[model samples]
Target: MRLMGLDYGDKTIGVAISDELGWTAQGVETIRRTNRKADMKRLGELIREHQVEEIVVGLPKNMNGTIGPRGELSMEFAEQLQNTFKLPVHLWDERLTSIAAERTLLEADVSRKKRKQVIDKMAAMLILQGYMDSKKRR
Candidate 1:
């Protein structure tokens, strides 16, 4: 079954999709946040287009492993997605995934402007790949 991954942020939501075999994920696009209706609409379109069967949303937690406001928001978003799409949604611990993505961009010498544009998308890929890797180990 195909899966979709998301890094939900304040301004944008990064999207990634798994391969048919569910082994790898690739960055798809970044959806700029507008409003709830609009955001869900776009996500739904991508879901349909990609024929996604499941969703994995990154859940940002504090260093102490406590769920903070951001984590709460991610949980709510995941619930909404599950309700709206009627697909299973899983929240993957996403602490520092963004930081890792930033470091990777810096190592690649990506320009600041470009890095800002794609950081979320890259993070989503990391989150999805991590989840898929965990599943593989099982």
Candidate 2:
């Protein structure tokens, strides 16, 4: 089964997808969030087009492992996803994933402005990649 990964942010939703074998992840398009309804509409199209089976959303938590405002918002997004698509939605811990993505982009010589534009999508890729790797080890 295929899975779509998301990094939910205030203004954008980073997107990634698992490989057909569900063993790898690749960066996909990022969805610019307008409103809940608009975001869901765009996600529905992606789900249909990609033949997605499940969704994996990044769950942001505070450094001390507590849910903050962002984490609560992510949960809300996951609920909407489940309600609309009727598919299982997994919330994967994503603390520091964006930081890791930022460091990676820096190492790759990506410009600051460009990194800002794509960091969310890259973070989603990291989250999806981590999930895929763990599944492989299982």
Candidate 3:
């Protein structure tokens, strides 16, 4: 079953989708969050379009592994997603995914403007790919 990955932020949500075989994750669009209802509507559309069976949401934990306010927000979002879509939602620890994504873009010599546009999407892909890789190891 295909899985959807999300890196939820205050202003936007980065989206990624797993391949049909659930072997790889690809970066999708970044949704600008207008409101909860609108965000849910857009997510529902993407879910249906991609035939997503599950969702993996990045949970931003502190370096000390503590769930701070942002982490709480992610948990709430995950709960909403599960209730709305009736699909399993998994929270994966996403401590430094964004930093790693930025470093990757820098290594590739991506322009700052371009990097800002796609950083979240790249982070989402990394989150989903990490989850998939962990599953494979089990």
Candidate 4:
């Protein structure tokens, strides 16, 4: 089944999609945060377009494994996603995914401005990649 990954932020949402075979993930687009209804509507459209059967949302956990404010927000988003899209939403620990993405972009010599434009998407890819790798290990 195809899976969609999300990195939810206060002002934007990073999106990613797994391959048809669910073996790899590719960065999609960053959705600008508007309102909950609008955001879910856009996500629903993407879900239909990608034929997404499941969603894996990045759950921002503190380094010590406690659920912080960001983690709570992510859980709320996951709940809304489940209710709005009627699909299974898996919350994956996303500690350091953004940091990892930033490091990768820096190593790639991505321009600062370009990195700013795509950082969220890259973070989403990192989240999804971790989930995919874990699945493969199992």
* Model 3: residue 99 alpha-carbon error in angstroms: 0.4
* Ranking, lDDT, top scorer first: 3, 1, 4, 2
For residues 17-126, write the lDDT of model 2, one tens digit per residue: 88788988888888998998899999999889889999999999999999999999999989989999999999999998999999999999999999988998999999
Candidate 3: TM-score?
0.98
Predictions in order: lDDT: 0.96, 0.92, 0.97, 0.93
- What RMSD does each model have against the real structure? 0.6, 0.9, 0.5, 0.7
Prediction-by-prediction clash tally: 0, 0, 0, 0
At residue 4, candidate 2 shows an lDDT of: 96
User: What's the distance in Å from true for residue 78, model 1?
Assistant: 0.4
Determine the C-alpha RMSD for candidate 1 after optimal superposition of all C-alphas.
Answer: 0.6
Clashing pairs in 2: none
Give the distance in Å from residue 28's predicted Cα in candidate 4 to where it truly belongs.
0.6
Model 4 spans with C-alpha error above 4 angstroms: none
- The positional error of residue 53 in candidate 4, measured at the CA in angstroms, is 0.3
What local lDDT score does residue 83 receive in model 2, on the 0 to 100 scale?
92
* 22-92 per-residue lDDT for model 1 (tens digits): 99999999999999999999999999999999999999999999999999999999999999999999999
| TM-score between candidate 4 and the true structure | 0.97
Candidate that beats the other on lDDT, 1 or 2, i.e. the better one: 1
Model 4 Cα lDDT, one tens digit per residue, 6-125: 999999999999999999899999999999889988999999999999999999999899999889999999998998889999999999999989999999999999998899998988
lDDT of 1: 0.96
